[model samples]
Target chain A: MKNWFRAAMAIFWKDILLETRTKDMLLAILIFSILVIVIFNFAISPTPKMIGFVAPGILWVAFILGGMFGLTRSFGLEREGGALKGLLLAPVGRDAIFYGKMAAMFTLMMVVEVIVFPVFAVLFNLSLWIPWLIPVAALTTLGIATIGTVFSAIAMNTRAREIMFPLLFLPVAIPTIIAAVETSGVAIRGVELAEMSRWIPFMGAIDAVFLVICPVAFNLIIED
Target chain B: MDDKPAIEINGLTKSYGRTGVLRGLDLKLDWGEVITILGSNGSGKTTLINIIGSLTKPDSGTVEFGGIGVRARATSIRRFIGVVTHEHLLYEHLTGYENLRFHADLFGISSADERIIIVARQLGVEARLNQLVGTLSHGTQKRIAIARALLHDPPLLIMDEPESGLDQEAQGMLDGVIRQLAESGCTVLTTTHNLDKGTAMSRRIAILREGRIVYDEDLKSSTGADGVKKAYASHSGESM
Candidate 1:
């Protein structure tokens, strides 16, 4: 058990080091997300009432698009040098690679969210300072990263990988995205946790199902 | 670790979408022997190595390591095998030292730093250890790939076309490294197109053609490079 955890952390650390040097995923996600927010800003009216009405959708869209970009690039790095084969050839368990990659994606998504959320709030002239928003974003990103990592691996070797990832990822992600947008809507309006408690359980359910299923699916798909 | 054969393949067969790669192939390597498979492109050399390395599954037959079937104990079998392919398999963003260290951690080598140093020095990559793999030359990258494969001291080393991009000096270094591994009782299976180098480094040579090993010979009786080349041409039906 200890060895498994150590192996997972080693993969995670390698990703962190590589990202620190290149910043490819982070930069791409950040730029694309910022562009998304900027486009939405111009597309929508800036009235306070208008911002409140559309803030959740815009915010979730930015997060999802940016997070998806990060997910796509995550596996691309592995494919570039045939590093996935090297990882698979190692003595480490396949689940360890799944966890490590999911963790890295989660971390990357969180970092991007942390940066993008405040900028989003400022741009939309809204408030997202509630503690509820944090958990909502965390749970939602966990679901995205979980499912996205699996599909990313699946699509990594495909000839049309860029087209294939979203086609596979978005449908499965609809439930989590819906829950996130709905909950974010409540949080943006400063509703009490009791009022949004219904959506929290649904989001948590999605997270639980995927957090269990994706790793197992990843193991099966990665093998010959 | 015992008196058993290091690797045994029995009637192995594989194909992709009606294109056969390995057709009823069988080979065996006793403990501490170095065998080089010589073949042209699409001749199933990589496919054979991949199956034995447990990186790919065969459509039929069995591969055993130390008398244990690979299908039932893949993870355990992988721990004993080190693989180097045509692809360097090193992360471009990470330094050579970092790449080796990461693989060592994955293999659970506690003495990773020491092992990385030793293997890197043996491959003469110690001086370039801190350089990013993407910025290094192909020869240097191949050296690091070799170092990564050797870090765990796996008993069975499998390499596919390991000499493709190497210079004469690096090729000489590779020969020495393979010889040293064999001397230390590590069984090595490598595929190469260079007849002379392959014959010189291996105790046995096999020519793979049309998805099967058509010619297998011991270096003892094969007089020199010319003999091996002629034999390869006759078996593979391709001029060297």
Candidate 2:
């Protein structure tokens, strides 16, 4: 268990260093998310009712689209120099690689969320300061990162990698997206946690299922 | 160090679609031995190395390391083997030092700093340690790849075309490194198209043709590079 954690952290650290040096994925996700928010702002008028009705969908659109961009580029550094092969050659268990990659993607998505969340609140004129918003966002992002990391690895080697990722990722992600949009709506409207209790547990269930499945699936995809 | 062979392959076979790559191939390497495989293009040299490195699966047969089959204990077997392929296998955006450090951490090397420094100095890459691998020349990248391979002090070293992009000095350093590893009782299996260099560095040389080893001769009994060249031509049906 200790070795597994060490290996996972090593991979996590490598990704962090590479992302910090290049800022490629972070910048792409940030720009694409900002564009999404700005376009939605123009497409929908700032009327309070309109903002309240469309805000959840727009916020999730930014996150899902921005996450797609980040997911597509998750393995870019590894593919650039065939460094994935090096990681595979290590004695570490395959689960460690999966966890490390998931952690890195989760961290990157969270950083983007931190920036995008405030902008989203300002643009939509919604109160996002509710205590439940943090847990809701964390749960939703965890689901996306878990599912996205596995599909990213699968798509990294395909010839139509750009087109392949969404086709494979989106269908599996519908449950998580629904949960996120629903819960975000509750948080945006300042609904009591008891009102969202049902949806929050559903989101947690989705996260739990993928959290158990993705690492196992990752092992199969990466094997010879 | 033990009586058992460091690596043993029996009836190893692999194919891609209808095209067979390795067909019932068999080979063995005793501990502390250096064996170089020389082959023409499409001779399945890289395929064999990939299988032994646990990066690819064989269609049939078995590869045993220290008498344990690779199929049953791949993860554990990987702990004992180091691989250096044609690909540098280093992140291009990362500096040589960072790349080596990452690999060391993956291998669970406790003294990673000392190991990286030693290997870098031995490969004459100490000066280039801080440079990003992508910005360096191919030969320098190869040196970093070698350093990464040696970081874990694996008992078995598998390399594919180790001398492909290296200059004379780099090749000399590689030769010295191989000799030192052999002296330290590590088994080395490498493939190269350079008959002269392959024969000179390895104690035993095998010529691969049509997915099978057609000719194998120990350097102790063979004349020199001329003998290896003639053997390769006669077996592979190609002139050097």
Candidate 3:
């Protein structure tokens, strides 16, 4: 157990350090997300009365798009640089590499959300500056990143990497994304924490199910 | 520290679809020995190594480490082995140091920071440790890959063409590492198409031809290098 933790921390920090130096992934995903949010704002004239009604959809759309971009960068770097084979040869447990990558990607997605939510709130004119949405955001990102990490590994091996990620990912990410959007919507509408219970539980359930499946599936995908 | 043979295989067979790769192959490798496998392309040299490394599943066979079945105790048995292939398996975006450290942590082998520095020096890659592997020369990257394999001090080291991309100097360095490993009582299994280098480095050599061992002999034999070449040529039906 101690060894696992140490190995996880090593992989986690290594990725963090790489991201810190490059900043390419964060820059691309953030710029792409903000552009999408800005385009949505311009395309839809969300008046004060209509803003709250559309806020959740906008947030969900932004996250789904942001996550897709994040997943591409996550595995693309490893695949392009030929680092995937090195990771495979390491004496570490294959599952640890899977979870470590999921964790790093999950953190990156959350950071993107943290940055985008405020920009989104102002653009949609929705009072979404709620404290409770933090956990909801974290849960949503975790679910998407977990499943996305696995699919990204799969897509990384394919001939059409750019097009394959979304086709393979969006369908599978639906349950988690919908549950997240619904819960965040409930929160934005100033629903009580207790009243928003169902969506949160649903999000947790989705996360729990995929988290267990992703690690096992990842081993099968990388073997080729 | 037991003196058992590092690897023993019996009737190892692997097939993809209707085609077979390894066909009831049998091998035995003992400690302090360096064995080189030579074969024409598609003769199942890589498949055999992959099975022994537990990277690929064999259709039917038994691989044993110190006489224990590979399938029954893969994890514990794996702790005794390491592998390096044409893939060099280093994360290109990460620095050489990061790659080594990650593998060290994975094997749960704790080494002082200085020890990592020492191994990097031994591989002539200490200066490149901070550089991203993607930016390093192929020879330098292969050295780092070799360093990662040695990080855990496994008793059996399996390398598939470790000298493939290396320059003459780097190849010489690789030979030194193999010899040093053997001198230290480690069993080394390597694959190469360079017949001269293979014969020079190994005490016993095995030639795989069309998924079967066509030649297995020791250095003391007077069969000469041409005899092994002709045997492989006749068996593979491919001109060298």
Mind giving the per-residue lDDT tens digits that candidate 3 earns over B16-55? 9999888989888887778999887788988887888877
Model 1 residue A6 CA deviation (Å) reads 1.2
Error of 3 at B182 (Å): 0.5
Candidate 3 lDDT over A1-224, as tens digits, reads 67667767777776776787788778877888888889989999788777666877888887778778778878777765456765655556667888888899888878888888889988777665687788888888899889999999988888898799999998998888778777777787777767578688888888999989998999788764
Name the candidate, 1 or 3, with the larger lDDT value.
Answer: 1
What value does the TM-score of chain B take for model 1? 0.96
Which candidate comes out best when scored by DockQ?
2
Candidate 1, residues B1-240, lDDT tens digits: the string is: 477799988999999989999999889899899999998889898888888888899999999999999877888788899999999999998999999999998989988899999999999999999999999999999999999999999999999999989999999999999999999999999998778778877869988888877888887877556777898888767766
lDDT (CA) for every model shown?
Answer: 0.89, 0.90, 0.80
lDDT of 2 at A178: 85
Flag clash pairs in model 2: none
**Could you give the DockQ of candidate 3?**
0.47
For residues B133-208, could you state the per-residue lDDT of candidate 2 as single tens digits?
A: 9999999999999999999999999999999999999999899999999999899999998788888779799988
Best by TM-score: 2
Q: Ranking under lDDT, best-scoring first?
A: 2, 1, 3
Q: In candidate 2, which residue ranges exceed 4 Å CA deviation?
A: none
RMSD of 1: 1.4
Task: Look at candidate 3 and tell me the lDDT of residue B75.
Answer: 54
